[model samples]
Target chain A: MYKKPSSRRIKKFYAPLNLIPILDSVFILIFYLLMSAQFVKIFEIGSDLPIMADSPPSNMKDALNLTVDVDQDEIRIFTTVNETLYKTIPLNSDGTFDLTTLTGILATLKGRYPKENAIVIRPSSLIKYDDLVKILDSVREKGSGKSSIDLFAQIIFGNLGG
Target chain B: MGLRFRGRRQKKQEFYLELNSLMDVLFILLVFLIKNYSANNLNIPENIVLPHSVASKQINQAIVIQLTSEKKLYLNDILVADLEKDKELADGNIITALYDKMVDAKQNIKYKAKTLGDIHGTDEIVNLLMDKNLPYKYIRKIMFTSQTAGFKEFKFIVEGKE
Candidate 1:
């Protein structure tokens, strides 16, 4: 006669859970995230009036564009040599300056020191921001097509009064 | 192994492992996980660097226009823009050059408009990269000039220290 096992007996041959596949999937996900993380850099600039931080700065070696102040009421345009000023122009109320033959003077200076890069525009602190923009716009517009260089590169926008 | 008669008897006994119900629960759980996976933890990088409050939005490999507090201009780290000596502003010729480049960009957009629906939109966005110490006047002038030349939208670049 054949012997039968007890009904309460448990089977030990059940299938084991395979964890290698799940772990492999997790690792792949991690690698994907790390590869996609992009590194970025950022920079900032502000709009309020500015103050010169340089103290006892030497005169610019290049020909400097300079804005002159005649009185509190008017601003002029000129270029500087050492500390001396020459060839100044009065600014209009609209900040659209009438060079008053100053362009010829500037042209002469440009010819004299053709390689100079320094150009300064000194306006009073009281000058409106809009006016300042207009003045800069006019300066930028001056060199459109004729000469390769249309404006000076190193501008010193300042006011002796400020 | 069991003998053939016992194996035949076992096969005819109507096996009830009840794996169908367990599979149904697992399938529901899997669907739930798949649905919520994106919302839970995806698209965020491991290193989260926050930019300055006013920093421009993110972009990929953009044209950088940098301005210094002293009114120095750098176009894409190249010394394309410079300040005029005796002038507190940028050289007019450089501005014209930039304007011409922008005009070309606009014309290119116009030419591509037939094939691309948003050609103008693509060119309107430029990355304005400014140093932290750069004055607001320079940026403002750039914005004004770019707008006049038809680049209305801008993305400001900021470098975060943290």
Candidate 2:
């Protein structure tokens, strides 16, 4: 017992320390961070396309460009200049969008602002895909694709699109 | 042989220390680390196979959206886009609401130029994150919608888990 107590005192005073464990812990921490981090790519939302009548105008002053708003049940085309909906077309239960009024209004706007190349399209989150496609086609046709309405155009998608 | 046996016996002094408690502590530490190993970091879906790029640069951001194999869109856990658009999927209102959110983001960028990257990160470069199965028609529709809503610089996000 006396020898055992003396040996314990010697161990407490002069025991050798091992550093391998500390080094192992450090390596593990580094590996963990690397494995847990999403370092390669980012995540993004898939946004749906929107429909509109006329192409967007470019470089225009405030309230001068045409704004097309596509709501859940209605397609509203209004002139920012006049501050009123020039045409409001509702979505048919069958899902086919007849924007004859919207087309005429867009033609009128194009004629009025012949050089205007910017048009803003704001589509609701719940508009049908086919309907949205039809609207985009109409807008492109009216713009003639000669002038890019992209100069000042804006396409706004909803929560679904975000 | 007797001398060798004596030397061996002398070297092998009968001393034992119970390391069971120390092993128990090590096991507890190992379990703790394993439990914390998975932090539920964002994972890119298997269906939305991102386009491969020579550029392996990483983009780290908080919000991420996922598009599935069937084209069902998800934002975090919210089902943003209905997969079954066969019935009727008019997304005008969706686009409008999305536009509002984007505009808010843009406003934030304008307020803090440092955060402008947030606007362009995914909005301007979307092609980087598209699966080969994605149709060109879908891409065009999104482009038209974005242009209509005033998004000049756009981003396309794809899977990146290299």
Candidate 3:
């Protein structure tokens, strides 16, 4: 109030810094990254190699190696040695497999052919990668709600996964 | 004196924010990201995406083969074969170059199982870091090449979620 109206008076008018806008953007960016980042995860799903150095055929000719292949539409389960079709799990309306159903079928297979431990999963060239893992999960773990059942823990690749 | 009093009143009118809580939240997020960032470095490309699964095991040390959605094949981070083009060879089912690379790697470590006491049981295993959606054929071809090279086991690197 006591300052003179001189040419240097402009220097006295200090513009307050508005960091709120910058802080808002930075907070938004941090939240976005936080929401997207998957923490404490990354696992290995090992498949027993069918063609090991001493790879020997199963003695039980009736029971065959399981092979699961997927196309753009549905996932087909088969036996590799004889190329026999066993089951087909179709994709849902949203282009997703009924994983629960697949898990049930796999559980039943385990119950019948308890000796057969290896399973081969081969997704088609046109399928999305995320969906393929989901299928693997279904094969590896079963039983929802309260209890968990492990199935076909010894998964392996077909002589040729393709 | 009046001018000084007016300046003090202006300072009193300006509202201040408590940034301690904000800093705390940001620090927590930063620590979380840094902790789990290693999972993203499984020789997978930035554009590539793996599948998420709870059924996972700890990854072991072995030869790493990464197949991206682009059909790009990487053996231990070195670009080896493009599955899009190198689908077949006159000699056998696998790509000639991949087979050769695998063989070279095999010869180096195969005998180590005997010498080093098989600390990781790595002499016969090949770790596969495949895109979830890649076709089964690529996997088969790679498996063939790996088998020809003498690897008898495979472990798939999958994104783990608990």
Best by DockQ: 3
Better of 2 and 3 by TM-score: 3
Off by over 4 Å in 2: A1-17, A34-162, B1-42, B60-65, B86-97, B100-128, B144-151, B158-162
The whole-model lDDT of each prediction reads 0.47, 0.50, 0.71
How do the candidates rank by lDDT, highest first? Answer: 3, 2, 1
> Could you give candidate 1's per-residue lDDT for residues B1-162 as a string of tens digits?
567579666675534455555555555655554443422111212222223432222353334455544445555454554554425345231265456666776677666766666532455655665444443445556665666676645554444333
Interface RMSD of 2: 11.5
Task: Please give the TM-score of chain B in predicted model 3.
Answer: 0.66
Model 1 agreement with the true structure over A30-100: per-residue lDDT tens digits: 45544543344433322212234667346455535454443334545555555465744655666555643
TM-score on 0 to 1 scale for chain A of candidate 2: 0.46
Q: Which candidate achieves the best TM-score against the true structure?
A: 3
Tens-place lDDT per residue, model 3, B59-94, is 778888888887888888898877677545423577
Tell me the number of clashing residue pairs for each predicted model: 41, 52, 9
Looking at every candidate separately, what fraction of the true A–B Cα contacts under 8 Å does it contain?
0.14, 0.11, 0.67
**DockQ per candidate, 2 decimals:** 0.07, 0.09, 0.32
| Candidate 2 structure quality by residue, lDDT tens digits, B15-96 | 4555556656665766666653534355566666565322222443323344555766554444555434732333342334
- Against the true structure, whose lDDT is highest? 3
Candidate order by decreasing DockQ: 3, 2, 1
Stretches of candidate 3 exceeding 4 Å from the true structure: A1-40, A51-71, A77-86, A112-116, A120-128, A143-146, A159-162, B1-42, B84-92, B111-121
Give each prediction's root-mean-square deviation over alpha carbons: 20.5, 16.1, 10.5
Shift in Å, residue A122, candidate 2: 22
